[model samples]
Target: MESLAPALGLGWDRQLGPSLPLSKVTVSAPEKDKWRRIEPTINTIWPIVEKADARAREFVARRRAATRAAA
Candidate 1:
């Protein structure tokens, strides 16, 4: 990230973001069972999730290429 910082014009001065914290909860569960309880709902929302994933991939690809060029 520091390597790409200059190319991307990011710095403390710009303060682009640290929007999401690098933290995670320990998800111990019969989470599969819990998820199965909502299987129908997940099926319904999965398409939207897929679309968002595709968009994010494209955005990241573009950003990487731009950073490479700037480098």
Candidate 2:
């Protein structure tokens, strides 16, 4: 059967169109206020974030090397 996901706007496969205009953006007080506490937690996690980024870079380097070898 043909997919209903695109018709229902549920899946990512469809390149439907540009997102709703910036003017249409929804502002949520709950979401905005929740991040106030998270800001300090993110600062505390800075070292962890740096390590994760370095690991990702190493993974990408390994993948590129393997791709070059296969080619």
Candidate 3:
């Protein structure tokens, strides 16, 4: 299954090692404008967004830890 991933152009290996830290990326104001434009709408449902983000982070952390342990 792992061997088939590369042939399919599905780079699963990229997610296996240490995760990228968000702080390492530098985003310019223009790049962030899209989100800024939606700020009002996002604020209306901020709680839902926060909850989903937390769940996603938890999922990634568990997956990364499991992969490292296997390695």
Candidate 4:
């Protein structure tokens, strides 16, 4: 399986590719590398990052839904 990084698309900061990208790119760039970029991980933070990412995803999802509903 592949990571969601590819699905996030171009132009967003590689280091913080959203909690997720549900809309079209707000900015455009030619390079593809930026999309596959992941946060630089170190051994100690592996489990900690996983837990944080799970919460981030849930929070972002709810926020997106609320924003869409309000719009």
Model 1: per-residue Cα lDDT at residue 22: 39
**Candidate 3, residue 3: CA error in Å?**
15
In candidate 2, stretches whose alpha carbon ends up further than 4 angstroms from where it belongs are 1-45
Quick one: ranking by lDDT, best first? Answer: 1, 3, 2, 4
Candidate 4: deviation at residue 9, Å? 23
Candidate 4: pairs in clash: none
lDDT of 4 by residue, 1-71 (tens): 02243332223344654355544765654456764454354555678788898987886676656656776
Query: CA lDDT of 20 in candidate 2?
Result: 35
Q: Could you tell which candidate, 2 or 3, scores higher by lDDT?
A: 3
Positional deviation of 58 in candidate 2, in angstroms?
0.4
Global lDDT scores for all candidate models: 0.68, 0.60, 0.63, 0.56
Off by over 4 Å in 3: 1-32
TM-score rank order: 3, 1, 4, 2
How far off is residue 9 in model 1, in Å?
6.7
Instruction: Give all TM-scores, in the order shown.
Output: 0.43, 0.37, 0.49, 0.38
Write down the worst ten-residue block by lDDT for model 3: 1-10
The digit string of per-residue lDDT tens for model 1 on 2-63 reads: 54554445754444465545347736543347678779999999987998989877877777
Higher-TM-score candidate of 1 and 4? 1
